[model samples]
Target: MSVRTMNRRAVLLAGGASLLLAGCTSTSAPARVALAAAPETPKSPDSVPPHVQAMYAAVMDEPYPIRASRMHLVPERFWRQEVTDPTGEKPGSVVVDTTDRFLYHVRDDGTAMRYGVGIGAAGFEWSGRAHIAYKREWPTWTPPSDMIARHPELERYRHGMEPGPDNPMGPRALYIHQGNVDTLYRIHGNPDETTIGKAVSSGCVRLLPQDVIHLHANVVSGSPLLVV
Candidate 1:
């Protein structure tokens, strides 16, 4: 064969081998495509339903004879509602479920008014049947001996702490008793709304100030109470 012809054949063979190799590489390799990232969704603030907002407005808008304090924003989950009665107690009875941090006020219509509450922590927890021996609005707070022993600074209030917005017992208090004996435990209001749905109180059950005010107005003395 001629040198030019041999060179042309060699060039053509080299070009064909390169094309074959490229085809094999393309067939074995996986395809890759770039994709746009998804946009992040903005989180919205928590809000209450229209009815609950109305109820909250009614409680907050009411005039207070005493010095009014700023209302703290509470989680919507703690809002009061009339739910089916789970306590099996007679109407007008109060049931406290410490584990769930809920207080149910039994109603005559086979439903209970449920309120979120802050319960006692650890050793401070108590459970048993009791009654609403009495109730008070803006009640005085007398530190129990045990509580005083834990914090000597409370000694000043050992006699009694005057009622005000700063008072631990916020707007109202329900004294619990058993058979005419004072249990020394109480269901009361706390100005700190964030405490609801928590277990951080000394021993007493605490509700939101507005909630306790509503409860105080409705609950009568000698109402049966069950703490479980």
Candidate 2:
């Protein structure tokens, strides 16, 4: 080929290579930018509200580690929050509204720390004035005689089920009593977060383990409990 034609061909090839490199660099730049700008996975408790963070920290700082596994992701609506007290009960009173599946811890400032709860199933529902006679941490589970009768599979646990993650009483329990008599009802923790905001228990009020840990730490024995 002619010298001039050879020079032109070399120039064209060099220009094409430059454009190809430029295209590759431009395409990769956006990918790098997207990775850098991508949002981070939110940190546990920290990404939650201030009050929730405080409660979460309190639970985790306990003598026994309330591990992350114990923390279940519940619906945003069911997450604990301080709302204007709807019930006119006196401060420090625990008012459980079965119809709404919410447990309210009345505060003096006209606000209540509301937590979602699971109430007794239709036939087993109970509502009346009661008091927290006592409290237990990692309480044992003893299936009642009637409960055992209905589900013979529970006969093995008739004696007692030791306190642990699998126990019906998740991390804490508050025994409800009418005067000196045991009402055979309780406010306790349940590991199943899906049950919250539903009526699926056998006359017991169930809260999430994290929430129960917070409530257990704050509520005192002898606290009046009104289930309505």
Candidate 3:
């Protein structure tokens, strides 16, 4: 087992424990592929697998509103799918390969559920073993003071950003911590589908809104998360 893989299993693990978030905010830098073409779709109607389209379909009925994404904006490879468990970690653990921008949730079976991710940019990337300290739906966002300095308009939200479709933390966020300290990183949602599989976040892992929602519901709190 990799040191970064979570072994101790617990769901909703830190019940009622207040989220100790340092704010995983994104910078204004544009993605390498500023506008993607084919996120919820494949090259052609014949190319798409029925499951991929359903995964990114408009998510209504959420406590917070989520707009249906335009298909064909992000590439198909980043879409959620099942694949071989390359990490060889215990079932139920989570593994993130930053280099490939893929997050895998190992299953009891011989495969893993993989979702595309937007990782931290060159200088802001981080690695190592961590456990999900907690998770939240419609989580509040508080941008770090430095992030505010760079984007003064964010100053108005210095205290905190409310939960909404527009919130940077999106509808769900998984807080990552090392030992007892907050690593100040998160696996959260981005409204933009084009950013998947690219290094665009400040230091957090970003996923499409629907993708993050699925990951959060399935991955337990306090699950081991390995980022390499």
Off by over 4 Å in 2: 1-65, 69-73
C-alpha lDDT of residue 62 in model 2:
46
Pull out the clashing pairs in model 2. none
What C-alpha root-mean-square deviation, in Å, does candidate 1 show against the real structure?
Answer: 29.5
lDDT scores for all predictions? 0.65, 0.66, 0.75
Encode model 1's per-residue lDDT on 122-187: one tens digit a residue: 556666666899999888887777766666777787788888666777778998877776767878
Q: Which stretches of candidate 1 lie over 4 Å from their true place?
A: 1-46, 58-73
Lowest lDDT 10-mer window, candidate 1? 19-28
Which candidate ranks first by TM-score, i.e. highest?
3
Per lDDT, the best of the predicted structures is 3
11-113 per-residue lDDT for model 2 (tens digits): 4433422110000011011111111111233345345566655554435544455544222355455678889887666788887876667898989999889
Error of 3 at 184 (Å): 1.1
Worst 10 residues of 2 by lDDT: 19-28
Ranking by TM-score: 3, 1, 2
Given candidate 2, what's the lDDT at residue 133?
Answer: 90
Q: What's the true lDDT of residue 93 in model 2?
A: 85
User: Model 2 scores what on Cα lDDT?
Assistant: 0.66
